[model samples]
Each structure stands twice: as structure tokens, then as C-alpha cells.
Target chain A: MALLQVTDLKTHFFGRRGVTKAVDGISFDLERGEILGIVGESGSGKSVASLSIMRLVDHPGRVVGGSVHFEGRDLLKLGREEMRTLRGRRMSMVFQEPGTSMNPVLKVGFQIAEAIRSHERVSNQEARERTMDLMELVGIPDAKRRIDQYPHQFSGGMLQRLMIAMGLALSPSLIIADEPVTALDVTIQAQILDLLRDLRDTTDAAVLLITHDMGVVAETCDRVIVMYLGKIVEEAPVAELFDHPKHPYTQGLLGSIPKIDEKQEWLAAIPGTIPNPLEVPTGCRFSNRCPQVMDVCHHVSPELQVVGPGHRVACHLYGETGTVDADA
Target chain B: MPDAVMETRHLVKQFPVEGSRDVVHAVSGVDLIVLRGETLGLVGESGCGKTTMGRLVLRLIEPTAGEVLIEGRDLGALSKRELRRVRSELQIIFQNPFASLNPRMSVEEILRRPMEIHLRISAAERSRRVGLLLEQVGLREEHRNRFPHEFSGGQRQRIAIARALAVEPKFLVLDEPTSALDVSVQAQILNLLKRLQRDLGLTYLFISHDLSAVRHMSDRIAVMYLGKVVETSASETLFNDPQHPYTKALVSAIPVTNPRLRRERVRLTGDIPSPIHLPKGCAFHTRCPFVMDRCRTEGPVLQETGGSASHLVESHLVSCHLVDPA
Candidate 1:
């Protein structure tokens, strides 16, 4: 069985304006020792889906319908106490900004050790040793002296390393990182990304890396899921997805990026901005901006259908004749 | 007018550390020249002083030392009256459109404010020009009544671009103008900027941490590390054949969009040393993989590299003791 299997997940936010469908009927499976990338723009409900799976959504936002099955149990069906225990043990989440996630006053090592102690009854000394080991493993040099330093003392790259270490405190089987290196500088970002890749090789943990950057997704992720307006528009292996993006949204995203290898006078920019969540379009989310948008695309929403081996795309281009591949 | 639209000679900015004897070495000695109708990309990691360099070019902040000349006229030497007059010649577009523009002000008011100060025109003329500016920036004239809050992030950025173009500035300091937007939206904004530059024949100092975006926009690219211009070359050549170790690491670090083309990463393993307390020689020496014994004591000067130099900016320039002089 897959490590984590999410089926028809629906997370909605109740507001004064209206019910905003953040993660609407999204389903995917993550296997052990795999890094699955969720790529999308802001308000595409990528972050909310991860939050839903973690059961960390607050009062206004609730998982209206979903089954996040992890280790033979439905995560959404678990009680408050049971769900709390599952988190930071079976699975853990790493946020975008490292500075905001950590406390300024507390020592960095102490906080990392605290994560371990929270899950298990370990002695302070034992936790401290493990923290130093994790720090060293994550490539933070001179861990002995740096352990006593506060979060403010650490640079952006160091802090992110600490965050990743905290995520691995309990040897969690699954890790969900949201825009992990977005806030970092390119040099530092490369270090962090390389570390994450290294962690995947060293550990059995399945990582769900959520990011807006296509280059990051291509570099790190083994598999890619393109999301738009709370729906999976495309899903494929990195190579196949990049080379043959069936959906217009995915194609637009690929075309929009200014490639470093070659020089082009003008980019194939998708015309309009992402529509507001409150007033979603009747049919396709990307129809407003799609260059090759058809008349039917403006009214009828296409279902995610398998095109090639392990490749799935949702668009009107492959209409009724599209076959659903059970293996995908 | 000179061939170069804007030129900076030995620009330096050192911010005094609060409650400490130390100073943040924000921008060390640097020289740059932005040619007319060309986009000069200033790329670096955060705290590398690309933004500070842009600000210094516009005289937004007083540089500790150096000269900023626009069309052979020194910004520092200008009197208050002369500065006011010269202000119309240069303009800046900041990163965040939401923060840069006033939330309360209407789109028309925001665009017209610059024209009102710079251009000696009637209110009626300014109003008509506001409509023209709105159209020029891909924003509708009907959006004139809308406040900043009502528009989307992309629309707000369009408004910001419109405001900058209102005064008809020859030189534009675009400091991460598209960084705040999404990729699709960012593409739109970038294209808009390129189109505007072409239409107005405006010179641009495109400062951004985003390498890919900078690669798309700039005619020539300069790689900065810890307030120093470590390397400068023609846009395509720099990426294809990066000479400096710092530049190589930076180029290598950039995630390849194509999975098939993943290159071997040259990792820089060390803490990014504090700018406040720089080392004896290079600021990047601690983290530099190719750090030599000489690099520990003596800094390298920015010199021309052994490349086919057709023009001044296109001539590959790198700062490293190892690189053979042209």
C-alpha cells in the first residue's frame, strides 16, 4: 500500500462573503521515499490541501469531505487527541519562512530537542546529542557552538536547516514542506534544496514539497501535480510533464518561465491574472487566460484523464475518447 | 548626451550598526554603466546591495562615497532646484506594488501625481495624460476611479508602472518589479516593462535576486556578492561561460527547469560571513570553494576577462585572482 493516500479531499473556508472552496475534491497517493511536488500559483489551494492533510486547519476552515489515509488509518476520521499524536510523529510539516516558525529568544538546539521530547520521554542530554547529530547531518558546521545560539543568530539558510531538522525529529514517515526555499537567496536556496534531496536518500520519509517555482519542482521532485483553482489539472513524472504538458495551464506555466539556457526576445505570457476565489469561473479555471482556449472550455469542466503511462491531464483537448488508466 | 545613460563610479554605502562600533558594509567600491535603451541587470543574493545600488543611482539615499551621473550630470553636485528638475529624468519602481502605491489614492491620482510635479501642464492635460498612461501600461482608462485595494496584484503593478512612466523618465530603476507577482503575472509585467522600454527608449537598471527573470530582461548582467560586483558579462555569455568561482556557484545553484540537464553542483560549504565583520580579503572567501592562500590576504580587482569584447558592457569582466587578465 502507498504510505499516504488522499481521496476526494474537500476543504472549505466559511467567511462573511461566501464559502471559498480551498481544496475541492483533490486526490493523490504518495509512496515511501518519494518526493511529490505540488506546483501552483497563490490561491490555487495547494497550501490548504497540505494543511487539510495535516488536520491543522482552524475554526473557519474545515475539511468538509476527505479521507487522508496514512498507515492504515483515515487521518480526517481521527479524534483531536489521536490526530495530535499522529502529527510530529507519523507526519510533520515545514513552513515557508524559517524565521517566523522559530522563536527569537530560545536557543536553536533546545527547540529542536524539545520536538523530540514532546513525542517521547527522552532525557535532556539524549535529545541534545540527537539534535547535534541532526544538525551535523544537515550540514550546519560547528554544531557544538551553534547549538547555543538563538534563531536570530542564525542566517536564513541555517534557520531553514534547523526547520528541516525539527521536521525529522521523530523520524516521521512523511514530511510536507511548503515553499521551503522560496524566501531564501539562490545560493542558500541551492544548499537547502540539496539538503532536502540528501534527506530523501538517507531517510525513508516521503516528502510532499509544495512550491510555486517550476525549476525547483523540476530539480527536486520525482513526480509533479499541477494544481489550478483547487483542482489537479495535470500529473506526471518530471520529464514527461515538462516535455509534454497536456493541459493549457501547465503549458502556459512552462512557457512563461524565462529559461536560463537560451535567450528569447519575448516570453509566451499568459494574458490575465488568476481569478478571485469568491467568484470562480463557471468552467475551467485557466480558460480566461489560456491561449488555445476552446468554446466548450468556457462551460464544461473536463475530468482528469490518463493520456500516457503515469500521465494524467484534465482538458477538453482529449475529450470523451480519453481512457482512465487505473495504474496511474 | 553621453552614450551611457547612467554611470556610477566607486559607489559605496556603509550603514552604521545601531548600538555598536561596527558598520554594515552594504555596498563596497563598485562601478557600473547603463547604456541608453538597454537593461543592465544587477543580480545578487539578499544583502548584496543590488537594491542599495539602485537606490544610490536614483539618489534616494546618500552614498558614503562615489559619483552617480545621469547624462554627464552629477546627482550629488546638483542644487535643490536642479535636483527637482533632474528628478523627472530618473524614476524608480519598487518590489511591492501594494506598499509602493497609496491605498487611499485613486489610480488616476496616483499616476497624475508624478506628472503634476514634473510636468508644467494644466489639470485637464494631466487628466488626459493619465488616461493615456493607463492605456500605455495595459490598464484600462476605466480603472482610473478604482483604488489600489480593489485591483489585483498584477493590476496594482500595472498602476505602479503607469505612475513611473508618467513623468517620461529616461532612466528607470526597476528593483524587483515582478518578484512579488506569480509566474504568469510576472511574465506579463516583465513583457510590459520590455515593451515600455522599447516604446520610450528608456534605460533600465533591473535589480533582482531572481536570476532567470534577470536573464530574460538584461542586455548585460552583473553578479554581486557582499556588495561587490564579482562578475559582469553579456547576458548569454555569462550564463554559458561563467568565470568567477562565485559566479559559477551562483549559476550552478540555479535550479534547472529541465530535469535532463541537471549539472553537477559546486557546493559552497560555510556560513555566509556577516557583512558587518568582513574577512581580511574577500567577503565570499569563507564560503568560496576555490579559495586560495592569496584570496585569504588580498582582494581581486574587477578586470576584463579573455572574451570577445565587441562593446564596453558586453566585455566579460570578473573579479578573482585566478582569472587571467584580458
Candidate 2:
């Protein structure tokens, strides 16, 4: 069985303007030791989906329907107390900005120890030992002295490593990292990615990596999901998605990026911006900007259907055929 | 070859630390020349002085030493009145459009202010020009009355571009203009900038940490490290045949969009050393893959490589110990 399976998840924000369907009817599964990437532009509900899965969405937003099945249990159905216990113990999260995510005043050692103590009924001394071990495991140099330092004392790269250590402290079965290295420099980003890749190899934990960067998805993810205006538009294996993107939105995103290897005089820029969530188009959300958009696309939403082996796309163009070949 | 519209000669800027004699070497000795109608990309990670260098070229921050020349006229030699007149020809587009633009001002007011100051044009003329500028940047005429908060990030950026173009500047220093926008929106802004450049014959010093965007927009690219220019070459050559070790690592680090074409990343271990207390010789020697004994004591100078004739301005130059000075 897959480690985590999400089905028809719906998360919405009830603002004064209207209901913003942030993560409207999304579904996917993550296997053990697999890294699943969720790619999208801003306001596409990728981040909200992760937050919804973790039950971290605040008051304005609520998880309305659907189930997040992890280890044979439906996460959405769990009670608040039970969900709290499961969070740091079985599933943890890493955020984009490590500096802001961590408590400013708390010592690094105490934060890790606290996460351990909260999840497991361990003595303070035992938790301290575990914290030190985690620090060493995440490759913090001089783990002994550094553990006493506050979050402010550490550099951006080191703080992110500390966050990883905290996430790994309880040996969680799953981790949902939302733009974990986006705030970091390219060189530092490489280090964090390497660390994550190494963690995946060593531990049995599955990672749900969320980012806007297609390059990061190509490098790190086993399978990828392309999100648009709160819905999954495309899903495929990493190699298959990049090589053959059937969904017009996915194709446009792939074309928009300036390739470092190939020098093109002009990039195929997708016209227009992401539509306002309050006034999302009745049919396909991307129809307003999609180049290959048809008249039917403007009025009818397409369902996510299997295109090739382990590949699925949601678009009217593929509705007629039901499935497209991997090469096509 | 086109004459350099703007040039910097060994420009340096250092911020003195509060409680110590040490200084933050923000931008060390650097020489750069931006030719007319060409985009020169300056790329580096945070605190590597790409932004400082861009600001230095515009004389936004007074350089601690060295000179900035615009149309062969030294900016430092210009008096206050002359500098104000020169300012119209040189403008900057900041990273965050939301922050750069005033919250109280509407798009129309923001666009018209530059023309009022620089052009000495009538209000009617300014209004007409603002509408035209808005249209040029792909924004609608109705957007002129809306406040900055009302528009999306991409639209706000378009407004920023419109403001920059309002004065009819010949040179612009775009500092991470699209970094704050979404991917699709980023492409839109890039295309708009390219069109505007072609239409107005604008010379740009494009400053960004995003290597891919830089590769797309730039004719020539310069790699900066610890307030120093490590390499400068044509965009194609720099991306394909990066000579400097730091440049090589930077080029390889860009996550290639295609998984099958993943190249072996030259991973540089350790953080960029604090500029306040820099390493002995080469600032990048601590992280350089090809560090040598000579590199530890002697800093390399920018030396021209083989292909000098083809480029419009300087030859393909790199500062590294490995390159033989033949």
C-alpha cells in the first residue's frame, strides 16, 4: 500500500469577498521513500494543499471535504488531539523560510528536544540525548556547542539544516516540505536537496515536496503533480512529464522557463496571469491563458484521466482520446 | 561596436561596521561597461554585491572610490544641477514593485511624476504619455486610476516598468525586476522589457540572482563573488563554456528543466565567508573546487581570453588561477 493517499480533498477560504476554493478536489498518493513534487504558480493552491493535508490551515481556511489516508487511517476524520499526536510523531513539515518557522528565543537543542518530548513519553535527559543525535545526523559541525545556540545565531543554510533535524527527530514516516529551499541561495539549495535525497535513501519516510520551480521538480521528485487554481491539472512520472506534457497548462509552464542549456531568442511566455480565486472561470481554470484552449474548454471542466502508465492529465484536448501515448 | 552608454571604473563601496574598524566590503574594485542597446547581466547570490554594483552604476549610493561615466562624462564631476539632469537618463527598477511604488499614489500619479520632473511637459501631455506608456507595458487604460494594491504582482511590475519608461531614459538598471512575480508573469515582464528595449533602444544593466532569467535577457553576462567580477562573457559562451571555477559551479547548479539532461553538479561546500573578515586572497578560494597554493596568497586579475574580437565591448575575461596568461 502507498504510505499516504489523498482523495478528492477540498479546502476553501471564506473571505468577505467570497469562498476561495484553495485546494478544490485534489487527489494523489505517495509511496514509501518516494519524493512527490507539487508544482504551480502563486495562488495555485499547492501550498494550501500541503497545509490542508497537515491540518495547519488557519481560521479563514478550512478543510471542507475528502480524506487523507495515511497508514490505513483517514487523517481528516481524526480528532483534534489525535491529529496533534500524529503530527510531530508520524508526520512533520518543513517550511520555506526556516528563520521565520522556528521560534526566535528558543535554543536549537530545546526545540528539537521539545518536539521529541511532545511526541514520545520520554524523560528530558533522554530527549536531550536524542536531540544531540539528530543534530549530528543532520551534519551540524560541533554539534555539542551549537545545540545551545539560538536560531538567530545560525546562518540561513545552517538554520534550514536544523529544521531538517527537527523534522527527522521523531523518525516520522512522512514529511511535507513546502518550498523548503526557495529562500536559500543556489549553492545552499543544492546542499539541502542533497540532504533530503540522502534522507530518502536512508529512511523509510516519504516526502511531499511542494515548490514552484520546475527544475527542482525535475531533479528531486519521483512523480510530479502540476496544480492550477486549486486543482490538479497534470500528474506524471518525472521523466514522462517533462518529456511529454499533454495538459496545455503544463506545456505552457514548461515552455515559459528559460533553459540554461539551449539559447532561445524568445521564450514562449504564457499570456495573462492566474485568474482571481474569487472569480475562477466556471469551466477550466487555465482556459483564459491556455494557448491550445478550445471553445469546449471554456464551458466544460476536464477530469483527470490516465494518459500513459502512471501518467494522467486533465484537459479537453485529451477528452476525446482518453489517453495519450508517452511519446505523444 | 556601439559606444558604452554607461561605464564604471574600479568602483568600490564599503560599509563601516558599528563597533569595529572592519568594513563590509559590499562592492570591491570592479570595472564594467554597458554598451548602448545591450543588456549586461550581473548575477550573484545574496550579499555578493550584484545589487550594490547596479546601484553604483546609477550613482544611487555614493561609491567610496572610483568613477561612473555616462556618455564619456564622469558622473562624479557633474554638479547637483547636472546630476539631476543626468538622473532622468538613468533610472532603476527595484526588485519589489509593491515596496518601490508609493502606497498613496495611483498608477496615473506614479507615471506622471517622472515626466513632470524630467520632461517639463504639460499636464495634458503627461496624461496622454502615461496612457500610452500603460498600453505599451500591456496594462489597460482603466488601470491608471487603480492604486498599486489593487493590481496583481505582474500588473504592478508592468506599472513599475511604465514609470521607468515615462521619462524616456536611455539607460536602466533593473534590479531583480521579475524575481517577485510568478513564473508565467515573469515571462510576460521579460517579453515586455525586450519589446520596450527594442522600441526605445534602451541599454540595461540587468541585475539578478536568477541565472536562467539572466541567460535569457542578457547579451553579455558578468558573474560577481564577494564584491568582485569573476567572469564576463557573452551570454552563450558564459552558459556553455564557463571559465572560472565559481562560474562553472553557478552554471551547473541551475536545476536543468529536463531530468535526462542532468549534469554533474560542482557542489561547493561551506557558506560564503563573511565579507567583514574575508579569506586571505581570493574571496572564493575557500569554496573553489580548483583552489591552489598560489590562489591562497595571490588574487587573480581579469584577463582576456582568446575570443576578444567578436564581443562588442570587453573580451571574454575571467579571474582564476587555472587560466594560463598566454
Candidate 3:
């Protein structure tokens, strides 16, 4: 069985203006020890989907309908106490900003130990030893000395590592990293990504990596789900998605990136910005900005359908035809 | 060779720490020359002094030492009134458009303020120029009446650009101007910048951490380490054949879009050392993969690599013990 399965998840923000369907009807499955990437821009609901799975949506936002099945148990159906026990024990999250995520006053080592002790009844000494081990594992040099230092003392990269160590303190079965390396430098980003890859190889934890960068998705993820305006527009294996993106949105995103090897006079940028969530389009959310917008696309939404082996795209162009040659 | 529109000779800036004698060596002995009508890309991680160098060139923050020469005139030696006159030729567009632009002022007012102060233009002329500037940056005249908060990230950036170009400046220091925008929007802004450069004959010092964007915009590129320029070369050569160890790691670290083109990345270990207590040798020696015995004690100086001198302005220079002797 898949380690985690999300089906028809709907998360909405109830504001004075209107309901903002942040994560509107998204579904995917994460295999054990797999790195699944969720790629989207700011309002595409990629972050909200991950937050929905973890049941971390605050007031004014609620998960209206969904099933988050983790290890064969529906997480949404669980009570408050049961859900609290699951968080940071079997499932953990790493956010983008490490500076604000950590408490300013506490030492990083103490925070890791607290996470470990919250779930397990281990003694102070055991937790402390395990914390040091985690810090060392995440490539923190002079772990013994640096363990006592507060989050303010650590650089952005180092703080991110501390956050990763905290997430791994309990050996969680699943990890959801939301733009884990976005705030870091490229060189430092490479290092953090390497550590994540190593962890995947060594441990049984599945990673649900959420990011806006297609390059990061290509390098780190095994499978990718492209989100647009709170919906999953395309899903495919990493190589297949990059090689032949069927959805126009995905194609635009891939084309927009300035590749390190190739130089072009003009990047084929998408025409418009992402639509405001409260004022999302009626039929297909991307119909307004899509290059090949059809009359039908403005009236009816497309459904995610298998177009090739382990590849799925939601677009009117491929609705009737199972596998239309997108390039041709 | 094209004339050096802006030149920095060993420009340095040091900030004294609070309640301590220690000083943060933010920008140390950086030598750079920006040729006319060319973009010199300055790239580094945060706290590597890319922004500080940009600010130093414009005299936004007073440099502790060295000279910023613009068109053969030393800005430091200029009188107060002369410095004011020189400021019209040099302008900067900051990274955050939202914060940099005043929320209270309308778009026209913001763009007009520079013209009113620098150009001393009449009210009617300022309005006409504001419309023209808006049109140039791909914004409509209607946007001029609205406040900055009403515009999107891209549109706000357009306004910022319009303001910078209002003074008819010969040079611009674009400090991560597009980093905050979305990928698609970033492309638009980049394209706009390039178009404006061609149309107006503007020289740019494009400061950004995004290497790909830098490569796209720069004629020549300079890779900076902790408070120093580690390498300088033509854009194509720098990307294709990075000579410095730091540059090599930076080039390899860019995550490629295609999964099939998986290049082996040179993973530099550890965080960048703090500027207050930089390593004795090379600032990057602590994290460098090719650290040697001599690299532990002696620092390297920027030296010209073996290449034809057809383009003296674009010659490749690297600062590494392994590449060239100090």
C-alpha cells in the first residue's frame, strides 16, 4: 500500500470577500521512501495542500472535504488528541523560513530534544545524545560545541539544517518540506539537497517536497504534480514531465526557466500573473493565461486522465485523445 | 575598447559592531569597471557584499576607503554641489519594490519626484515624461494615477524602473530587482530591462544571487566571495569554463531544469564564514573542496588567466591558489 494517499482534498479560506478554494479537489499518492514534488507559484495551493494533509490549517481556513490516508488510516477522521499524537511523531514538516520557524530564545539542541521527548518517553540523557547524533547526521561541524548555540547564532543554511534535524528527530515515516532550500544560496542549497537525498536512501521516510522552482523538482523529486490555482493540472514521473509536458501551464513554467547550459534571447514567459484566489476563473483556472485556449476550456474544466505510462495531464487538448503528441 | 563608465579602485566598507571593537568587513578591496552599454553581473550568496558593493558605487553608504570614479571624475573628491550633479548620472533600483516605493505617493508623484529634484522640469513636462516612462516600461498611463499598493509585483517593478529611467541616468545599479517576482514575471521584467538598456544606451551593474538570470543579462560576470571579487570573465566563458573553485561550485549548484541533464554537483560544505571573523587565508577556504596546504595560511590575489587580449575589458580573471599564484 502507498505510504500516504490524498483523495479529492478541498481546503477553503472563508473570508469576508468570498470563499477562496485554496486546495480544491487534489489527489495523489506518495510511495514509501519516495520523493514526490508539488510545484506551483504563490497562489497555486501547493503549500495549502501540504498543510491540509498535516491538518495545520488555521481559523478562517478549513478543510471542507478530503481523505488523507496515512498508513491505511484516514487522518481527517481522527480526533483532536489522536491527530496531535500523529503530528511530529509519524509525520513532520520543514518550512521555508528557518529564522522565524525556530524559537528565538531556545537552543537548537533543546528544541530537537523537545520534539523527541514530546512523542517518546525517553530520558533527558537519551534525547540529548540522539539530538547530537541528528545534528552530526545533518552535517553540522563541531556538533558538540554548536549544540548549545541559539538559532540566532546559526546562519540561514545552518538554521535550515537544524530544522531538518528537528524533523528527523523522531524518524518520522513521512516528511513534508515546503520550499526547504528556497531561502538558501545555490552552493548551500546543493548541500542541503544532498543531505535530503542521503536521508531518503538511508531511511524509510517518504518526502513530499513542495517548491516553485522546476529545477529543484527535476533534481530532487522522483514524481511531480504540477498545481495551478488550487488544482492539480498535471502529474508524471520527473523525467517524463520534463521531457514532454502536456499541460500548457507546465510547458510555460519549464520554458520560463533560464537554463544554465543554454542561452536564449527571450524566455517564453507566460502572459499574465496568477489569478487572485477569491476571483478564480469559472471553468479552467488557467484558461485566461493559457497559450492554446479553446472555447471549451472557458466553459468546462478538464479532468486528470492518464495520457501515458505513469503520466497524467488535465487539459481539454488531451481530454478525448488519451495521448496527443504535445510537441508535434 | 569602450570607456569605463564607472570604475571602483579597491573600494572598501567596514561596519563597526555594537559594544565591540570588531568591524564587519562587508566590502574589502573590490576593484571593478563597468564599461559603457554593458551589464556587469555581480553574483554571490547573501552577506557576500554584492549589495554593499552596489551601494558603495552609488555612494549610498559612505565607503571607508578607496575611490568610485564615474566618467573620469572621482565621486569622493567632488564637492557637495558637484556630488549632487553627479548623482543624476547614477541611479539604483533596490531589490524589494514594495518597500522601496512609498505607499502614500501615487505612481506619477513617485516618478515625478526624481524629475522635479534632478531635472528641475516644469509640471507639464514632468507629466508628459511620466507618461512616456510608463509606456516604455510596458505600463499604461492609467496606472500613473494609482498608488503602488494597487499594482502587482511585476507592475510595481515597472514603476520602479520608470522612476530610475526618469532622470536619464547613464548607469544603473539593479540590486536583485527581479528576485521577488514569479518566474514568468521575472522573465518579463528581465526582457523589459534588456529592451530599455538597448533603447536608452544604459550601462548596468546587475546584482543578483540568481546565476541563470545574471548569465542572461550580463555581458561580463564577476563572482564574489566574502567581501571580494573571486572571478571576473565574459558571460559565456564564465558559465562554460569557471576557473575559480567558488565559481565552479556556483555553476554546478544551479539545479538544471531537465532531469536527463543531471550534472554532478560540487557540493561545498559548511556555511559561509561570518565577515567579522573571516578565515585567515581565502574566505572560502573553510568550505572549499580543493583546500591545499598553502591555502590554509596564504591568501590569493586576482590574476589574469592565459588568454588572448582582444577584449581587454572582458578578460578572464580568477583568484585561487590552484589556478594562479598570488
lDDT (CA) per prediction: 0.90, 0.90, 0.91
Give DockQ for candidates 1 onward, in order. Answer: 0.85, 0.81, 0.79
Instruction: For model 2 chain B, give the 10-residue run with minimal summed lDDT.
Output: B306-315
Report the TM-score of the second chain of model 1 against its true counterpart: 0.97
lDDT of 3 by residue, A1-328 (tens): 8999999999999999999999989999999999999999989999999999999999899999979999999999999999998989899999999999999999888999999998999999999999999999999999999989999999898899999999999899999999999999998898888889889998879999999999899889999999999999999999999999999999998888887888898888888788778877766789899999987777677889899988999899986432332222
Q: What is the TM-score of chain B alone in each candidate?
A: 0.97, 0.97, 0.97
Cα lDDT of model 1 by residue, A238-314, tens digit:
99999988988998898899998888889888888898998777676677888888877777777888899989988
Which parts of model 3 have CA positions greater than 4 angstroms off? A320-328
Question: Which candidate tops lDDT?
Answer: 3
Question: Which residue pairs overlap in candidate 2's backbone?
Answer: none
Q: What is the lDDT of residue A286 in candidate 2?
A: 86
Candidate 3 residue B110 C-alpha distance from true site, Å: 1.6
The DockQ-derived docking category for candidate 3 is medium
lDDT per residue, candidate 1, B162-241, as tens digits? 99899989999999999899998999999999999998899999999899999999999999988999999889888999
| Cα lDDT, model 2, residue A195 | 86
**Predicted model with the maximum DockQ:** 1
